[model samples]
Target: MAHEAHSHEHGGGEMNWKLIVVSAVFLVIGLFLDNVETFRFINPYLVLLIYIVAFMPVGLPVMREAWEQIEHERDFFSEFMLMSVAAIGAFFLGEYPEAVAVMLLYCVGEGLQDRAVDRARDSIKRLIAFRPDFARLADGREERPEAVTIGSIIEVRPGERVPLDGRLLDAPAAFNTAALTGESVPRMIETGHEVMAGMIATDSIVRLEVVREASESAISRILKMVEEAAERKSSTEAFIHRFAHVYTPVVIALAVLVVVVPWLASLFSAADYAFSMWLQRALVFLVISCPCALVISVPLGYFGGIGVASRKGILFKGSNGLDAVTMLDTVVFDKTGTLTTGAFRVEQTVGLSPEDLAFVAAVEAKSSHPIARAVVEFMQGKPLATVDSACIVNVPGYGMTCGEWAIGTLRLMKKQGIVYDEALNEVAETIVAVAHDGRFVGYILLADTPKAGIFTLPQRLKAQGIKLMQVLSGDKQALIDKLIAGFHGHGFVKGYGDLLPEDKVSHLEALKKEGKRVAFVGDGINDAPVLALSDVGFAMGNMGADMAVETADVIIQTDEPAKVVEAIAIGRRTRRIVLQNIVFAIGVKVLVMVLGVLGVATLWEAVFADSGVALLAVMNSIRPLHRPRFEEK
Candidate 1:
């Protein structure tokens, strides 16, 4: 299921606004009776009763929670424990107004924290809404997406979303894939082309055969991955949790020392110091030393960062993935699917007759390779002679041969001693040599255009101090080199082509051995091995294979190379904001604790130290959610 049973509902359950209202009313009356001389006729005991009544609404819940922690979990030093103890201690010291106000402010702070988290969760939820709720069946009846079965032909009109992953059964049409790929460009998909869910048909009506169930669709899986991301904590979050475990008990012990040690020193030195005065300071110390700010703000910062990434069409599997992205110094890319569009088109046909084209198409039809598929797609309009595939011979790496005609790469031609013109080898396009029996027939040129803004991606990575950026592909070395040379202005450190799946992993392994934090980016299915082996794996979500999406730690939903840089920027910003909160929370609390114990800081200062700093930290966590300069669009 895309959504799960979350323990805490986003945006704290319906707030006790009535309780807050009652507390505020009693609090105002109590302060007026105590401070204003006009109300001096009212009994002091009655005013104390008003203060106690005001404290009850907010304080009772905190006290019960503290009690539950002690009785059930054998735990102390939680935020509830500190607030409850401090409030009760202040009340006993006859500081009734301070006690009531502390509880009131803490409740307000809790409400604010919950609201901040809710905002971040809602931002992410908006991105996951890409999945269409209904699919138009062939019979023109719209049904729930989950009820749509595989092999069911669905009709989608212009502006309607494709409800499930399917293969187009109708003629080619334009689709707006911004929701899926994060790019606004409309893509033209042909008949038999696979289309993912969450894409909107923008031009003409399109019919497709559902290839996957709703639960197994790409949109469903992406939503599921994002929903579960928060369960996996980062190293910083785990450390803060451990720190709270030890820090809380130690600070509580110190608060006890602040009271007993001062009173004992006063007795021994024969100095005039009231026990109540020392005890009041100790209560203030407990209030100031609460660690709610650090604990709550750190996780909220990571969530905010994840929300920002989702807006840019990037999905981090966890905060750890976001943390890892901040530390990445090296990035590896797969050429065909990662850097280039991976959609091959026929650029030119060389010295080929209609009969020769038919022969080439017949031989390519027997292969499942992407280049072969491109060849078959190009031969759609041309008249082709029908040839039976009863005796087709398959050859890996080289090409295939059907009876008399053989079609493949120049390497295959070289192996078979079929002579071909040397001029064909000089072209940058992927050359497919066609031969009949013992003689060379002709060659067809196929080209996969690089995606827009890909060249700018390397430069941006370099600007961010990414030390190494390279492309690894199984295409010809000359083709890869020519492609890299075209983008001479960008910082492409190296390009290695003619590599198999294992070869890519070997290169990545070598980089890891050099003690560098390596990130491998590719369309998941083809680069699964390398993606799994790297320190961090980034998958092209929009066009990525299922295996890649499942294995990758981060998925670029937009399939845009620039989003990688944006992801890194968000990661770095999140880490900085979290650190700022931790340091600021701890630093302010420590300073306030010292002042409180020294009798310089009062209950008013304690309230700000506990609740005010927490609000500030929560506000700081949403910094990354705003548009960064590069992501203005």
Candidate 2:
């Protein structure tokens, strides 16, 4: 997965502290001269002069934008339009202090929003920073990561980050993968194991042969996914954006009527109508009508949630995936490499002598299947004799053939007309039958252990109101039943076995037909179709295939089942915060606007309605940024 350089473009630039300081000085001077009789020697116009200067720096940018909205973009309903109109109207009405205060408060609010959004951007920026700038070569030469070529060896010393994705060339070493996976525990990697960039060498210095360029490394991909996630807005965010655009123009029209209709009506009647007062009231209405709160807060809430999830090693490709997780009623998980460790170990061997086991190991060594690798690993350190053999042939969905013998499934032996005296019954474990010259030699039993987190996942999800907890696998029904039996107290509802890849997709389709929003979790190439077909797809990042990464909506970098629970919790919290902001912003703005229309609310209250609510909503949006505690790995 090659990634382009991450874009660091934020909502806006850093706060203009110099501008703030100068404006504050002018405001203080204006206030002192206007209020203090001791300063009466200064002309009133001089005080107004100070105030105008104060307003220009902080308020000019906003007024300019409002002007551009009308003159160029033809967008007259912007918050800037409302604020600029209100502040200038106040100046015209001889409310000089109020006019200066209005724009000053708006500047403060804008500064706060800039800071809040920058904080959210920092969440992913910190991850991008994990990519080491330089790598120490095998010969003690330090060079830029981007300059390192493939097959070049690099040395990662203790406490130093691995610079690129590569194969370990040194002895087995422990590396801390928290930067990439968010799991604090160090993982031990064998000499030939593939090691991703961004992991720190925790125990000893390790040499690695670079397998990927800096841009194509795992860290690059993770950074790319997380940074781009903000582009995918949730339904709530999109609606608020649309609402703001439409709401602004309508409010402007209403503000116009507030000024014209009442003044016109008063001219035809006996009611005392001061045009200035009515005009001032319309200005207050404009201030209250600004849609800044809803526009700034809603998206911040989602981005905050995404930042939090990234810290937890969960990469939600978009806000849509984060949104979808909250709506999941049922989560479907693949058996291998998901709930259970995909690595198999030879548990037991039946009716096999030392020589026979060695011969089988030799035959299995010629193949690269996981089952074969398990057999080879199990036979390690054993004094086994290697037999000279002809071409090794692989039988799809069955086993492999070596010379005049076959080592594979019992069905393969049956297909080859090999008979065994042992009564073979389908069980929860994997069994590979070995034959010699069309005669049963022996069978080796292999088993994959369930991940530690899978034990408690079912019960936790059940407690969270997930109604049906099930496992779908292509393994035999007897094995699936046995695995399901162990999960009795864990709240597993059903187990579907003897399923092909398409069968899994069909089951998900059926669930969708039943109105169940399903999230499928898997890490293999075969899981790609079902992963894409599901409502939300969770791919185990550590061992996941390229296809899975490309298709799955969410990538769990740590490969922790507990993260599934964490993701759901994150989504729920994020959605809650988003709703809270929407309701609070809208609720506060509506109340203040009604009060402003009735002439009960002042310019001060209007400022609060526009900026205060925005500040509060932004503060509430960042609640998800707090680090969470997960079960021990």
| lDDT, each prediction | 0.83, 0.83
- Candidate 2 least-lDDT 10 residues: 1-10
**What lDDT tens digits, residue by residue, belong to model 2 across residues 372-423?**
9999999999966666656678899899887887889988988998887546
Q: What lDDT tens digits, residue by residue, belong to model 1 across residues 69-106?
A: 67766776676788888898989989998999888888
lDDT score, residue 581, model 2? 90
Best by lDDT: 1
lDDT of 1 at 355: 83
Assess candidate 2 and give its lDDT.
Answer: 0.83
| Per-model TM against the reference | 0.86, 0.88
